[model samples]
Target: MLDRRNMLKTLGAGAAGGLTLAGAAEAEAALTAQASEALGPYARPWSPPNDKDPHAQNIVALSDDYFVPGRFAGKTVIVTGCARGMGRMAAIRLAREGANVVGVDWLADEGRAVIDGIRRDGGKAVFVPGDVSENAVCDRMVATAVDQYGGLDAALNNAGVMDAIYPGDPIDYDKQKSLIMARIDQASDDYWDVVMRVNATGVFRCLRAELRQMMKQNRGGAIVNVASVAGLRGFGGTPSYVASKHAVNGLTKNAAIDYAPYGIRVNSVCMANTATPMVERAMQILRERARATGEGGGIGMIKTKSLLQYSDQHARDSTPAEQVAVMLFLLSPESSNLTGANYATDGGFTTY
Candidate 1:
């Protein structure tokens, strides 16, 4: 990927705008020819050749062309919770970079839409509609990779849920925050059960299935489990969520050690305050709560600091793509030396 990018950069730089059109064209051709000779042809695997077909054109138009292709060429990947947000973004990005994605999610319509988008972009993908919290579904996810793509090369276990306790009113941020910050005694058994089952146990099932398959393949593969910054420390407020994430972190570490001999690298990306749909809803609630209080800084003042220790530019909330970038790194061969590591993509939120 770096090589291809550098070659393109060199080619573009050679086409000086100061030169005449014909001269510039000649320079570009010459540079391209040199690059071909050195790099054995500049291949654009991500996009098909420009043709008169309107369908192909539309697909190209929708495709993310910014990524360097062939990174995961000939690889089959399984992405959980790929209907939207981080999971959706990672699945599409992986497909764009030449991976055959097996996306699993509970939302059938949205999951199919994501798969359709990948197919429209000339990328390979298939959607499996199911809840990851079930062991059968987790097994099926791994089975789909084998049945459809022959074998699984990698997986991004990005399925997890937060403990949401709403105090009746949707717009009342104070009540919402109170419910969120509720202590253990204030929480119910169902609340803890749902969070742990989905976030921790669901991941455990997926990891087991993936590891078993990778071991059987004997080719070795990578796995990146999606954890949260809550796993790293006790920030209070959401006890179930923090505990679940901590369990995920521990599971990632233990699996990494157990599977290292088999060449299966296991790691987790701990993120915080990413601009996901869940976070967006939370922010909106906070904003409304601030308005209701209408005092000298209510939830507004603590909103940012609530998630992070710092409020500087470096500590800004990350986009879905930003988190996926680190996940890709961990899944790729570039991170072969990195295993059993909880990579914090927290944007300095955990620095303190």
Candidate 2:
């Protein structure tokens, strides 16, 4: 068996001493990490999600991006942003566990892929085409689940745009002026609005509508929002994504508190960088910068080296989307009493 300490030493070896040319470069790169301590958008006085699952059977929680069978038997679930990446992965996993899954996405083609994959695996899933930001669209998605699955027992609010990420470095003196001119310059006001509308506001709308229906059912429900590691921390690059998700965390706590009177459980799956579309886009942008600057030069060796390094980190940052879904199950009746918690599905990124 490999010793964890030695393993980490090996991993951090390349990043050692700031002596070699490579080490110096990585050290400089390391300084790009932000230290800003923005507060979490809101406080939690709410119920934790899936606080109910662990007691039902001998079922166990997944540690990585993997799953076991029957994790969510006899449940009806709605997953937003199921068109691609983690959302799609989660939707498929729920269906495989014998839940009726209602998937929503803006990407029609990718949405269909999720449905198709679920069906291929002998699981039930329905793809609804639309944006989660719109009340009408959100309403319709929920309606599809109720209309088809009898009633929604759990809803995973995983739909949201991840268009921004920290650049790992703050702006230099040359780039500081324009940034200082605007309060939301790093991510911009427009960027903030767009992200807030889709990521944070979408959750508010989704949970509000979900709770209203759950209240009508007079039955309890569980909800999980897809927040991020940045939500737990803060950002100097894409401040908006961080801000929006932090608001989501607050929304989860508040909703959990309000809805608990009616037995509704609300929580969030706060993740990190992962091999998702959002991270891919961020990497491409960084690589483009490297190319444009000729910093790493012709072969793009240094650029490739750094990009792959960051890419691997982001990939390791998140568990498989399905792995996080297990927490959603625990929030339901299976676990029996958990509520109002912010579960970190990050690969220890927040521990730092």
Candidate 3:
């Protein structure tokens, strides 16, 4: 009988941790060797495995006694950014629990495959491939949920992008830290516009569309925006990304207030350093950069350390699955009393 605390301990211990000189040395060598494979377009062609079981990626097996299945059963959900990473996983998890899912993303092939995989497993889902930055696309996304699934009950606005040139390096610890904590003057207007368009404005459009649909039904709904730990605090290198996420937090809070009377709840999930496709890709690039500069290879180590310092109990931050569980809880009726919350899934990163 693992208590909740113990269960978290077991899981977090597996991935959480800060850097040790010895450990960083070893990790740097390994990461450097793999850097070549990581350099490419940000989008990974790969999707989550499981055309056969669809729910095979379930971190906690359904058979586990502690597992309470189908919390979202009979609900309709619109999951943007469904082509890969967290969005793909959440879409699958909800459908497995009997929710009808409408998955939207710009990656048409991958997005359709996600839907196909869901349908193959007897879960209801449809893919809408579009950019969330456009208002019309957002409208069509919600409309798909209504037309296909009858109505929308919830949404996860998880699609976002960083600056086209997200800098990472193999520089000294101090320099790396300084570079990451980009000063406003260092960031260009172009960088700000690109990031804000997708991360902030895109989410704004989705919230408006989803809220309208939810309001029309008078049934109330829940929304969970995939904000980053950057949203909660400033980071050095990526000012635009940080600012955009801050906007997400604001939209989430204000929307929660405006829609509470309508029974709609809005919240954002603030993740510190979750392992996702985007992060992995960036890590690869950083590893490559470190090798070029002849740094001691603690680049990856320090980033992990940053996350671990805040969450002493865990070696790393929350998993996409763990984050999804929280997102599900927020969207489900179970969180009826919770609203306007920026739930930090940062492994305690903000506590200090």
Candidate 4:
């Protein structure tokens, strides 16, 4: 008798045996249905926590109205930074949309929880715990997607770092301020190197791996890099972060130009301040600064002011789902005509 693991292995092997697109779709449906049957009634719908913090909202699930059911069926996708925030949401949505997902992150426990949650919801996914800064890890990510799901169809390069290499204690105001709001002259060698390694070089490495795999498969694929508004325009403080994001946008354009002949589409999402854990941590630091110095002008305030000036929406950060909506569109067939485009997911923040 075939166990669940062996059964999935057999299905994956069959998929890799050169099935046509239509045949692959049928196989994919059968795989999902059989996987669900293997789990029986124990499978349950997974939902994000109902947290009071806006940044923590929309962590696990996207709204039913937002996703096109089975849009990513038979496709294999890779998502980075899958432990939390936008990356987490992207992974969940991709699996929910019927994509076999390979989730990569350095946060092992949290990342595994995400993959486990997807499985619990009757979705196919696996977690690879490693930092994208390493080239070997990037290659392994693509390998996992292919080995587990037959082939790679898409990827969301969403892993990134801002401010500091490591988080400081809440009472360490001086350290936090320096890390979060340092000028170019004030930035340290360690600070610049860490940011570039993870943000700029990391995306480059991921793109290289994903593009190579798609090229080898001789089939078209889609990729969405999570850039930032800083990539489009300038921002005070966080020079390393801004420069790294600009590098991401540049890489997106270059890759799209070179790989279009291979039928691969590469694009990026330049987002403003979103309600993510990264932004929330920065906000906490700025709020502390405000209380200590009684000053109002900080990163959060500046972003809020800019958002209010250009958009009709409320003066607040965007939710993770809002950004993921744009990402999913770029990854799906709906945005086939778009390549090398650095789409601003900001609420009109970069217009002026």
Which tens-of-lDDT digit does each residue in 65-160 have in candidate 4? 244557898999999999889999899878767789999998888889999988876689999989898999999999998899888999999999
The Cα error of candidate 3 at residue 106, in Å, is 0.9
lDDT of 3 by residue, 233-328 (tens): 866556778889999999999999999999999999988777677777556545554565565433324444443434232334355776777887
Give the alpha carbon lDDT tens digit for every residue of 260-281 in model 1. 9999999999987887876776
- Model 1's number of clashes is 0
Itemize residue pairs with steric clashes in candidate 1.
none
Stretches of model 4 off by over 4 angstroms after superposition: 1-65, 167-171, 174-179, 288-303, 306-314
Deviating ranges (above 4 Å) for candidate 1: 1-65, 164-181, 284-315
- Is candidate 2 or 4 superior in lDDT? 4
TM-score comparison, 2 vs 4, better candidate: 4
Which is the better candidate, 2 or 3, if ranked by TM-score? 3
Better of 3 and 4 by lDDT: 4
TM-score of each: 0.73, 0.68, 0.72, 0.77
* Stretch of 10 with least lDDT, candidate 4: 56-65
Q: How big is the positional error of residue 279 in model 2, measured in Å on the Cα after superposition?
A: 1.5
Provide the clashing-pair count of each candidate structure. Answer: 0, 23, 11, 0
